[model samples]
Target: MDATPPGWPEAVRPPGAPDWERTAVAWLFDLVPPDYRAHEVLRRYPVLLARFARDHVAAGLEAARSGWRTVRVELADHLPADAMAAAMTAYEREGARLAAAARGVAVVSAALRGERWVPRL
Candidate 1:
């Protein structure tokens, strides 16, 4: 456990939470797509918000039980050994997929809520 929270923005720390960073981080991974723009998702996809929350929380709990180390090992085994560029490309694509999903959720949420001023990502 980190004594001092790392890579946490001062803004997102919940008020009166003892472990704000941990709380926020767990929120990001466990909740609907943890990012600064997630608030936008809340604004747009009003209908799916409950579903996303339920599924995401379940996934988070399962991931915690399984542990990250095992997941990392599985990911490593699937990477291309011969072509470094291909491996990098695959890595980038997967990251983009996650980002796109987050963006989609945010955009849909915002539209549903009829939000006017969405902050720039």
Candidate 2:
């Protein structure tokens, strides 16, 4: 795992747990569209976040799981592979954008909690 440098920003860590990146990614993925994300992306996020946490800011895994569950419910009827693929591509792009925004929110939340900031190396 990558170590946080001394005096890093508190926003680097997520609220309510030490595994901040997992929590943050989970939270960010929640904002994504349900149909595209539930099946195509949800399964991959945990592993991806695990790697991300090793190298970057912390995230929220529970939030991601909840988002996946909601997405699955929203898209109960599965679509053809072609349509699913297209939708998933769009969702991934949007999800990345949303993740960045969520990161900002995580940072702010950390500050509100009075946690120390740690920069990702």
Candidate 3:
């Protein structure tokens, strides 16, 4: 019953992957009760988000990194049935893109640092 969608193996970390929790915001997610987590990130982490956004903007950027600010919108419940489905499609598309990009960047960086293997053809 693994509900993971297809094309997600790129993002799934292998078992026993080195822990990075101390260096990332994923820990902020576990603070929310699962049933109540859906709309809680912005409400709970506004300070952190604001600081990050400010830092991103001060770097002479007009928008937050990766479009963070507009990511938390909540559409009214009155939308047509297809609206939620469309949203899900968009979310999935972005999620896949981000995951793939992260994997690509990490591998490239590791290779540059002599950590990832580079095969000769």
- Which stretches of model 1 miss by more than 4 angstroms? 1-46, 49-80, 83-85, 118-121
Q: How many backbone clashes does every candidate have?
A: 10, 21, 0
Give residue 43's lDDT in candidate 1 (0 to 100): 40
Candidate with top TM-score is 3
Instruction: Tell me the TM-score of each prediction against the true structure.
Output: 0.33, 0.29, 0.36
Residues 59-104, candidate 2: write the lDDT tens digits.
3433444454465456647766676556656556555654655455
Query: Tens digits of per-residue lDDT for model 3 on 2-95?
Result: 2322232333332224432121223223322344335556445533533332343234222223333344454546556587666656666655
lDDT of 3: 0.39
Q: Which ten residues in a row have the lowest lDDT in candidate 3?
A: 20-29
* Deviation in Å, model 3, residue 48 alpha carbon: 23
Please give, for residues 1-121, the per-residue lDDT of candidate 1 as tens digits: 2222222223334323465434443444344565534565644543455347545645544544454325445566665665544555555565554444444334333433443332354
Candidate 2 residue runs with Cα over 4 Å from true position: 1-84, 118-121
Q: What is the C-alpha RMSD of each candidate to the true structure, in Å?
A: 13.7, 13.7, 16.1
Best-to-worst order by TM-score is 3, 1, 2
CA shift of 9, model 1, Å: 27
Please give the lDDT score for candidate 1: 0.44
Cα error of candidate 2 at position 101, Å: 2.9
